[model samples]
Target: MKKLTLFASAFLLSLGSYAQQALWGGTNLVSPQINEDKTVTFRIHAPKASKVEIEGDFLPPTKVDTPFGPQDIPSRAPFKEGKNGVWEYTSSVLPSELYSYSLYVNDLKMPDPNNVYQNRDIATMTNIFLIGGGQADNYMVQEVPHGTVAKVWYSSPGLGMEARRMTVYTPAGYESSKKKYPVLYLLHGAGGDENAWTELGRAAQILDNLIAQGKAEPMIVVMPNGNGAQEAAPGEAPNSMVKPSFMNPKTMDGAIEKAFPDVMKYIEKNYRVYTDKNHRAIAGLSMGGFHSLYISAYYPNKFGYVGLFSAATSKQVNKGVTSDVYENLEDKLAVQFKNAPKLYWIGIGKTDFLYKDNMDFRKILDNNGYKYTYMETDGGHIWKNWRIYLTEFVPLLFK
Candidate 1:
């Protein structure tokens, strides 16, 4: 055992030395150097490549036509030609927000070799940076008390899964303290899993900062996979390791709403959480929004607070399928309202594809004399708006 351990240690040391050498090789090269001003300078060393360009949310968005409507996607801009084999581009002054950028060399996508800070959204990986000083600061990690995030597995018999995974975020002092905390069930959009809010939405950072500054109540945030068919995120499961597509037919088909009780049950059983309508909140984005809507309406007296962030207000039409979860919508809303949830909050971007759908849903609420809070911001269906909504919505919970 000693001999084997020593051999493994030597191999790891050699590997570490190699990594150090490779990292220090580009010590003088800085790809993304945040300037004194907010403008950012990006660099890439592609001497042989005929062309180099960058695509990111930092640039003017490109509007593209989709089935729902024209949606704004990231725009691409060319980088200046090579200077001493270093290709570069300096962006215009940007606002405070999290930004992601992808590099292209000779029309082929490539990761920025110089920047190690990157995040994978589905199959594509892009380098990311935060231009802080405003709302973006809420998404950043600061010298505040951090929270505990656990990937817990629980039985979901309602969904026909014996055990499934979820991401739970407990406040900074949760483990040491005995007092019970309220819970916010934070669902993700289509193509997202339990990890989405923590990674892309910055749920943990936002929660930590809010609680530290006493801007919001300290509550447990539960992020579950809304897709009823999947046991967990793509690679985390025992199934295929291939990248999951951006859309899944199984999501938002009334099944998640039917099975939501399993999730709530697991949380209430394992964690130290208050068990009542007033102490429970549920919110989601896109398909998650749809799930939130139907789930809250289906379980009328369950949640005190309901937030719909750019949610799909309409249920997906499945032919030859009848479910109690999807039927009697206005009746359910009537009951949901009669019970009088403390907040029925809705937020969406002006240019989002689902903007009209949301407006139409609001019309239903208006005609029925149901009162709710609404917020409209400038942007399309994107993470920027969802993150903003989360930061805004969380503070209003349990207050």
Candidate 2:
């Protein structure tokens, strides 16, 4: 019995020693520690890595002059390594906002493994952190009455798609109340899916907060997957990750325009949405803005309010289009304006690369005598400006 006990003890000691070695050799790191002063500190455990760097929208914008125009890119900072192969960088005091960041270990970029809150924009994914108590605080989930965000699968026979998915946001009291609410079809930009509005744009929180404060009317927000070739976001769709070329700008081929009617049909059939032009609104960012423009023009009498944020305008639409659609663009605009939407709003950043394009489109509107509300703010083509556009635009809707 003594010999047996000694053997068991020896085995246990060996196991414990192995565990200690593993713990010492491996890295268990906590990242994006939000300091009390609103400065954020990021950490990475890459002991043998030659270099580490952090890049994010939280840093100052880097201005670069491009052939088309001046462009503002997100700033990047190098991280200093400390004891035990840990690298760290603390940012200056930043405004209240949601920021996405990624780390580069040597030359490979990756999200912080410690942070479960991450967002995928286009082809890249990064860790996200929120700094609270300002305009950005509105973006955070708060104690206010919340809304229900549903990931729904519906059939779109018109687009030849059977199992498409979209996200629907119903305001608080939607289930309890029998009253029908106005609908806002919120579209996502290129490379973004239905999840973009809620996950990255913080649409739910913005609507919830605005509605709770009585600043805006309670409305149903529909976020549809604008990519026609795919059913939903990356992992949500079958073979989506593998065949994402459907999302490529070259292949999109005005699929969103063709598939829009199906989106409306699904929403009107399933939800308690008001079925009137006056109560219906459409808005989008970037490529979505182009979709909004084309959709509003294609079915001018359908939507009462139209908003375009940092829109890709006529320049993009006129590319390689010899169809009747391109031929009658101006005539279609005339007809669209004749219907007279309640609000035809355009919002863009002054420094946005698309600024000249937007200005050119505005000139066309000006020459045609079509009335529109144009808002230009600081910053470039970033979510920061898009969020501001949403906040200011929603209050003016459904009035």
Candidate 3:
């Protein structure tokens, strides 16, 4: 009986040693490992999961033969399960870009546990990875003089909201320099708050790289919460996770438009900003674009530069216009043109769903004899396009 007991102990020790050796000798299991040729390999450990799939913007485009010709569709693929609960997938060579992805484990989407870099778009969160080179390198943080981004709270009497939050970016030498700097009121799209630009858009990195390269001027950027009802993002709000009302045109009526004065008042009172319209610029993506257009038009001569990136031109005026505020939008735009901004710029992607609306709005600008520059590029209404638009638009401001 003693000899049998000793034999059992020896057998258990050998099994434990083999298990440790197998784990230590295997690959390190690094998720999102960028290859020499720009392809990426992603891995996740989910031993209990029945199936896993990887979906992201970095996947190679699928070519579908359409009536018009071949159309490229975004792709998602299943991850192959390997030994010891490891699931892995290798992507085809992708363009140099910042991509967001999530794993579908047992059909439930979740951010990658292995990837530390994550981004929040509205309520959904996803993992992010960058394939660097070309324009994408600009999005990455580099060895350059950086700016300070602050989340600030201020009074908004205009909207009858006592306090609100905004994200402000001051240039590298702003604190040291005695000279006042130009201000750009940057706005985000629907379902987004002031944090959108800095998070998904990588606004700070872009600004730092641009200023370092002398591609953009040294200026301050103010990103205000476009949703009038919500003071800040999800957890930062007075009541955590307040439903965003920016999507409802009726809810926005007189809210954001009236609150503009308060936002400017708070900024002017606290920050050293250029007071004139020439040094004042306003721009936004999607819904924010619509706001910028109307705000600039409503208060003609207030903004010298106006940029719209895939703006919701179709819904410029609310469906039910009981008040005369937006009744004479055309006249307002005419007056705005008469005042003449230094730069009236419009940028839209070729495949954007709002392309038709943007074109129709351009006709109105044409009819009013408005002088503006138009830029068309690839891709649809995505953050990638917005970031590109921002990089292009900033270089033209404060010139």
Candidate 4:
């Protein structure tokens, strides 16, 4: 037994010796290393690659003409070769915001292999990092109390899916206490699922920081999958592991709007929440913005606070009887405003593709003398703008 134990110990030592060779610290190379001067240095070890470029939103924007309008897109910067085929580039002083980027080697686009921090937008994945000391400071996990986010499954009878998934976030101290909290039904844009807001938009982190600071009221946030045919996000449902797309059937055709009650019912029944309109808020970005608009209007008096961020006011496809949800918008808005919601907030980027559509929708409200707050920012339909909108919008809820 002593000999066997000694042999086992020797074998473990041998394995440990081999493990150190394939570890992370050996490279001493960091793709994104934040500097004291606020500039970020990115390094990639690709001695064989001839040309390399860093593509991220932090760089200066270049104007690109599209069908919607000319928009400022993220431009790339060349990486100079360093010692030992290590390509490196130091960025200019960057503002405090969550940034995402990809690397191009010889014109082929790919995520930074060195940076394990990444996010998925539709079928594409890009590395993400946060620069602290500004709005993005809220995006980072601080020493304050944190919230609990869970992937829950509930039955949605209307969609004919017996069990569907949703992302629910409960604020800190929720479990220890029995108090009921206001609910914010935060929806995601197209190509996003229940995971979008929490992952890409930093919803959980923002809420935790805001609630801790007492700047925002503690509230329960529910993120539901807007796609009707999809039981959940890609790979989340049984036998449905496929690449995510921006558009899906039955999402905007009123089926989701009709079926939205299932999500609320589940939340109200299973979680400790206030079931009144005054305690309810619904908000989304882009496609999610459209959903929030129609759902709140269609079920007028359901939510007291409504927010649309870079919302796409049009592009509703007709799918049989489900198309009625898209119709009679003026009438629906009339009914919705009759009760005079506590807040009707709208925000969009100046260069957003749906800026005009949002404006057209606003004009309808303007013509009808409806009361709503509007905020416009600089940028297109991207996550940077959406994160800013969320941080701005949530503080004003349930005040």
Candidate 5:
């Protein structure tokens, strides 16, 4: 047994060493240093492969006009191969957001020889590189003013999952300080898990930037599993049912009161979080936004701030406002209508499918005497819109 352990350790050490060497090899992986013009280049030495393409998040499917010239959505950017079969391409202009991309070697997905910063959402992870002026820090992993992110597990009797692990971002100064930061419960959309916001939304970076700018108040952000199912991270299409499991109000309610409480209690006991109404907020996108509406409106005392980004709410439909409608709806919206929270923020893109929803919600707010801020931008349901929303919303928080 001792010999086997030593051999395994030695094998891992050798693989690490080999990986480092491959990174340093001049011909294989070449990190194309991006220029001031935001133009970046890639060089892949795949001489054995008949075809090679460079894929990245620099442009949209229709807007792809790189050296490869107009490829499909998530298409391979063509590379000009050399005498030794080394392929290369130069980008038009890359954005500032972190990107994940890879090489398609004869239709097989593979990592870029030159690129680094590889991460995984599930077992199927991707590889890509960062192209920006100064990305010395992994902004996504940086600490929020009042929190630290820790991966944890909680038992869910309702879902029948023995113990489900999830990620939580505890605010900074949580330890050693008697002060408790407000809790901001965030949820991901469909086809995403608890790690979605931390991974792709760049929530930590947005909080850090907002806190630095003195726009947002320091707070704890909790990301929990929204699906009331055994599947931790399901695919785009969930299992077909006579009626979707998620549509069951009893199941969602049970999950919220039971599984959600398990996560909450764990956080409250383990971290320094406030236990008051003013110090708690809830927000999400898509399905997550639906959860926020149900949870927050039902338990209004728990959250002092509520946000809906491209929300999917029945209350938000393009119907003209009237006093009779307002009277009948005030009770459903919860709260005293006039004095609900510190802020009720709704954000949507003009081009987004939820644009009319935002407008309708604003009308409802106007009719019911409820107060809110409706932020409209030029984007869609993609990460671009979400990131922009975070940039605008975080600054308005904790004030």
Candidate 6:
């Protein structure tokens, strides 16, 4: 009798696992189906629970990353209790390009067994929702004029890493056309990898739109792994935490100067790229931004245009008055401005925590008689503002 009972328990467990797998088979529970009313419905049938609601980045113009973009729908509607004794709720959200959401019961974030688009990149599973089903043209890998995206690997002697790989997006007509194109070295932020710009920033689409509109010159964009550690960028093992390393010039110089030059030499020799300072540009976000500032200044002759977007420039913090990121390096950086670089552009959101730093940096430049452009918009440190900044900054490159 005990043997029979054990067999029954094992069979039941296997059946439950199969059922769970089937539930998340198709669309994934995280991607809610958009009803004709333009309303989104998120359902979790935990009927035992007294309360439940949906939360996510449904609202627009709101901070998504920092404040955490999620909203709780009031549970006024009666939840239909499923056979498994679970409750569910559906809510509507205004349309947008993309969003992230999840079910929260009381305060715990619950996973949707029915939704398949759930991303478990973070420790807690989060639901990913896309409302406006546009081409995401900004993020698409295109075949126009024929640009090639190659995943290539290299060894970095500076950081003592072997087999470091990155994505290089060559513009259309790169293969057939003998014309050498300008290169834009773009960097991603913290919690992002080499593919961040291509995936989330819609980099190709932005470049396509700009080129088509005659707003910007067509160029190759090299997205490198900003983290010194090799495993970090690919989400592989041996991942190292990314911190603000711009304050320490020794480390920044070692990584950017020695390690990055290897990437440049490899590109120039293999690809049909322009090998001059006038055709080279570098820009980045957050930690990448600090790298941009210091890297450009340190090696002024290497790049012509520099862009900083929503960056953390200093280790020192200011309540609302000033930033020390550029304070110590002011005199040395001024020499870079005096010597090379056609365009030195800095972009930041007014409400961003780094706003004061940006403003203070601008003042330092102004005080030093440096000619640069400063862009101020309404936003915090988020991708929305960075997207806008990229659109604006790319056009000014190689001009």
> How close is each model in CA RMSD to the real structure?
3.5, 4.0, 6.9, 2.8, 7.6, 6.8
lDDT of 1 by residue, 1-399 (tens): 999999999997888887956745664678788897999999988889888999999899999998877989898898887667788899999999999989999999887888888876766788899998898999999999999999999998888899789999999999999999999999998888899999999999999999999999999999999878888888998874867877765675667888899999999999999999999999999988988999999998899999999998876434465778888899999989997899999999999989988999999999998889999999988889999999999999998
Residue-pair clashes per prediction, in order, are 0, 0, 0, 0, 7, 19
In model 2, the clashing pairs are none
The C-alpha local distance difference test score for the whole of candidate 6 amounts to 0.67
Model 2's TM-score against the true structure? 0.88
Prediction 5 global C-alpha lDDT? 0.65
Better of 3 and 4 by TM-score: 4
Candidate 2, residue 359: lDDT: 95
Task: Give candidate 6 misplaced runs (Cα > 4 Å).
Answer: 1-31, 34-49, 60-96, 110-125, 130-147, 212-214, 232-234, 237-254, 315-328
Error of 5 at 85 (Å): 1.4
TM-score of 1: 0.93
Q: Which numbered prediction scores highest in lDDT against the true structure?
A: 4
Tens digits of per-residue lDDT, candidate 3, 115-198, equal 778988886778998888888888999999999999999998876677889999999998888889999999999888889999
Clashing pairs in 3: none
Clashes of 1: 0
lDDT of 6 at 371: 86
Once all C-alphas are superposed, what RMSD does model 4 give against the true structure? 2.8
TM-score of each: 0.93, 0.88, 0.87, 0.93, 0.73, 0.73
- Sliding window of 10 residues with minimal summed lDDT for model 6: 67-76
Expressed as tens digits, the lDDT of each residue in 280-346 for candidate 2 is 9999998889889888888888999999999988636447754343346678889999988999999
Tens digit of per-residue lDDT, candidate 6, span 1-399: 999999999997888787855654343243366777767766665656766656554543333334323322212233444556555556654544545566766666666556666543213356665554442344333454445677777766766767677778876667777888999999877656676686667687778767765788889998887766553343443554434232322333335534678778778888778888899999998877877876776666888999999776664532332323334577658678777589888899877877777888788788878888788886567665787789889989997
Candidate lDDT scores, in order, read: 0.90, 0.85, 0.85, 0.90, 0.65, 0.67
Local accuracy of candidate 4 as per-residue lDDT tens digits, 1-399: 999999999987887787855663357788799999999999989899999999899998999998667888889999999889999999999989999999999999988877889999888899999999898988999999999999999999989989999999999999999999999999998788999999999999999999999999999999999999888999988988887887887777778989999999999999999999999999999889989998999899899999999987874433354377788889989999999789999999988888888888899999999999999998888899998889899999998
